[model samples]
Target: MSLEIRKIVRFEEETLIEGYKAAETPLRMFAVAAVVKNPWAGKYVEDLRPIVREYGPQLGELLTAKISELAGGAENIEAFGKAAVVGLDGEVEHASALIHTLHFGNHYREAVQAKSFLSFTNTRGPANAPISIPMMDKNDGGRRSHYLTLQFNINDAPCADEIVVVLGGASGGRPHHRIGDRYQELKELGHDIENPAAV
Candidate 1:
């Protein structure tokens, strides 16, 4: 079955000043959301995999394209994440099903040529619920600077039988990132950097 998308929402923001200091360049953040009709609303499906298989890749392609465009290009996106909100009539697992699959995430990961996993959030809520997409460095999760979140809400989304799926990205880190990355802390604490399992 094809995805029945009601609307596609796009959000972008730029920060030029932080901590009373100008950033070397504007730090930009972007997100694209698709409001879709939940196929199994009001019914408990024994297996959610079928829908996940059918719709996940489609959403991955659609949102990745939109988010990449918003960030200028996939190559320009330094950080990335995703989120989903299932309507009150649906289960939280429905929200999770749409996004927590390789069929969905692989598209974004491949588009950006990323090594690290994409960050994500999923929940069940009513219209205009707060949607927070936590992000991390596309290639280096240990990088503290690229740790960020893109939060936005659709005033009339997930209307009891709908779901809002989203993808978010950033051109770079915060305007003034002073905190060093986690890897640095590991070294300072004398952790065995060579064997990752020890840490």
Candidate 2:
């Protein structure tokens, strides 16, 4: 079997809440999620939930590292806050597993003597997990792309100034076409392919 991994699509945004303030010290929240491609899920595999559960901790580690880098360092994560994991399409159950693994990121705060506070949206009734942000792409030729967005909010905390956010997506080779070279070749051949959907 041939395996290829690519980030077919990605989006990131950060903002400094200038005037925002928390009522208590060491107050903040963090959230992270990944959209992974499970090649062997729901097909040859008898049970994927267990596998996803096992992988959740690993994914959490990756997200924590990314957030630590984004936050400048683990020392700066004093006011740890609410954290969550959300999965996109074909990943509902995986989201629950990811949430279980999210706590692995809190270990970083141990060295700083800071409390790591976080919560995961449950998979049952009122506690059902929250879906990450929805991503959509459409073209005139019936070509479409989709993605999932993860979101986190820091609430009422002062010890931490900002929360580092990270997102990971899984992509197979299906949507990995290169447009730059194709566009150039098309132009050279007197074909207009300009204004391709700016994803």
Candidate 3:
């Protein structure tokens, strides 16, 4: 089966003044979404490998290109993430299958030459549902300034049998950010800096 994409939506957010304090450099975030037909929308498909395998890399590449172009190139992106929204008739698993794969995320990670894993969210919703792509520093997940969310929506997407795959990027983090990074708090708590999760 072929990957059938119905449309692509791209949006960008730029913040010059955040909380009444002007950002030294404007903060910008971007998201690219592709509306595609869900083959197993109304059926119970135990193995989603066929489409997952074929479309994972395809969607990754397709969305990555758009995101890269928006950021002026992959290297220009300092933070990144992804998300998927399945139509009302589709399973949340279907949304997860497309985005939570190595094939899909590796493309963006490799393109940006990032060390951190791509953050993500998957859900089932109707047309115009909120599409939120939570992001973090491309190389440092604990970086508080780079922690961000790129959100937008399409008026008529993921019609009952469709899925919207998304990729997001940020040229810079929150303007006027004051909170310290997670690592700092961990250090104060006497947690090992080497293995942050070590309690």
Candidate 4:
């Protein structure tokens, strides 16, 4: 499996106003996505789960750093505001990787609350499809784990400026994939993936 990470920066005047109005402080809104290979689909793979599990945290850190750079700097980062992590066709397992990566205290705990992250599963077809994921719980660990595409959205975070987006694929002995191209296409076509004004 292969993983490709992509970052999109959108400047929205309204988002900035909204963030300031809501938080009563200077803020910025940004959207991020990660595309990775699905190890559970196509082939009857074994033991690859650990690979994703181990790399999940590392990927999340990378994403957070990237977001900080996009936001200008960590000191300038006021909030995460909104975010999304979507896995394209053939990679539903990638969703778990993302969930495990951003699970409250896992990464930006002090910056983003546990309840601010949302998760969705089983998304297949075009990589640029519009996505809607309802808010989810940080402690409700009862969700079933399955093989299918997945998506995630996060909102009302204080570390939006420093948030990094990561897409990871199988390490070493696996093929790599690139889904950033499709995300870029969707962005150019007017998809509401990024909230530039939220901060």
Candidate 5:
């Protein structure tokens, strides 16, 4: 089924420092959000699996494309994530139904050639509530530099029967990163470094 989108929003941010320190190049984060009518709002259904299964891929493709566009392009996006907020009348499960499945997430993951699973949030809120989209490196989920969050809200959106779905991307990891990457941690811990878990 097609996504019954009420509105779409995009957010972008660039950072060049960690506190007072400066980085040679800036790190950028981008998010694309959609406010849509929640089909199962204000009612309890014993089965939510089918509804999510049918709609997940469509929303995944649509939002992933939007985020990729906002972040420059799929090829340029080094980190990625997703999120959803169900309005007051909707169950938190409604929000999760839209984003938690591979049907939705794999589209974003494959589009950016990311090996890491998309970081995500699912919750219930009122209009204008904060939506945080946490991100991680596309190739390496545990990369400290790529762990980030893009926060935003739609002032009048996600009304009683609505849900806000978001997809996020980043051009690069945190600028001036000093902690190190996950591969290094694995090596230091004497763990198998060749096959890492998907983040």
Candidate 6:
């Protein structure tokens, strides 16, 4: 069981304009993706756990390092996310198996010291299909300003038996976050932030 990586793709953006307001410095967001052969493409395997587990750390280390480098560094990161796209011949589960695992996602979370879970997407598609990676504040899921989604497409990937795995990072939160923080919402509602279910 091995991931025959075909290629690695990276997309980056630095925004100076958010609607009308200008950011003092551009807000940076980036994603790094890998196109690899799906080991269980056409089989209905009752057990995907072992294969999932085996690939997790290998991809986690590779992708986390690439994304961190693209975003500047792990310390510069303020938000994070991940996503995957499986080729038409593969099941959606094949896409999900690579990303929806602690073995894979934990590497990025730990690298950025993010307490929040990595937001994700998984689907089956052809080459050049749109892929989106949803993100949140590394340390606080409730931080609305840090909630972001990075999107990109690979022109030639997931060719019926491959999967595209992605990792995303942001250098800063929304440039013009006027809605207020999660703590403010908790305070206004007289709700304790510690126990959110009570709210």
Candidate 4 ranges with C-alpha deviation above 4 Å: 1-27, 44-48, 75-88, 91-93, 102-105, 110-125, 131-199
In order, what is each prediction's RMSD in angstroms? Answer: 1.1, 19.5, 0.9, 17.1, 2.8, 1.3
Model 4: per-residue Cα lDDT over 1-199, one tens digit each: 3443333433321222332344233223333444443434444445555656655665566555555555455444322322333333334443444454443224643333333333333333344444332222232222211111213333321121122233211001101212333335546776644552232
For 1-199, candidate 6 gives per-residue lDDT tens digits of 6668999999998899998989976899999999999998877888889988999999999999998888768999998899999999899999999999999999998999888888889989999999998989998888898888988899898799899999998988888888888888888898888985686
lDDT (CA) for every model shown? 0.92, 0.35, 0.93, 0.36, 0.86, 0.90
Q: Assess candidate 2 and give its lDDT.
A: 0.35
lDDT of 2 by residue, 140-178 (tens): 121222222344322221011111123322121113223
Q: What's the lDDT of the predicted structure labeled candidate 3?
A: 0.93
List runs of model 3 lying over 4 Å from the truth. 197-199
User: Candidate 2 or 6, higher lDDT?
Assistant: 6
- Look at candidate 3 and tell me the lDDT of residue 160: 91
- For each candidate in turn, the TM-score is 0.96, 0.39, 0.97, 0.43, 0.90, 0.95
Poorest 10 consecutive residues of model 1 by lDDT? 190-199
Q: Give the TM-score of candidate 3.
A: 0.97
Residue 18 lDDT, candidate 1, scale 0-100: 88
Superior by lDDT: candidate 5 or candidate 6: 6
Give the better candidate number (1 or 4) by lDDT: 1
Candidate 3, run of 10 with poorest lDDT: 190-199
Cα error, candidate 3, residue 90 (Å): 0.5
> After aligning candidate 4 to the native by TM-score, how far in Å is the CA of 195 from where it should be?
34
Give the top-scoring candidate (lDDT).
3
Better of 1 and 3 by lDDT: 3
TM-score of 2: 0.39
Which lDDT value does model 5 have at 186? 82
Largest TM-score belongs to which candidate?
3
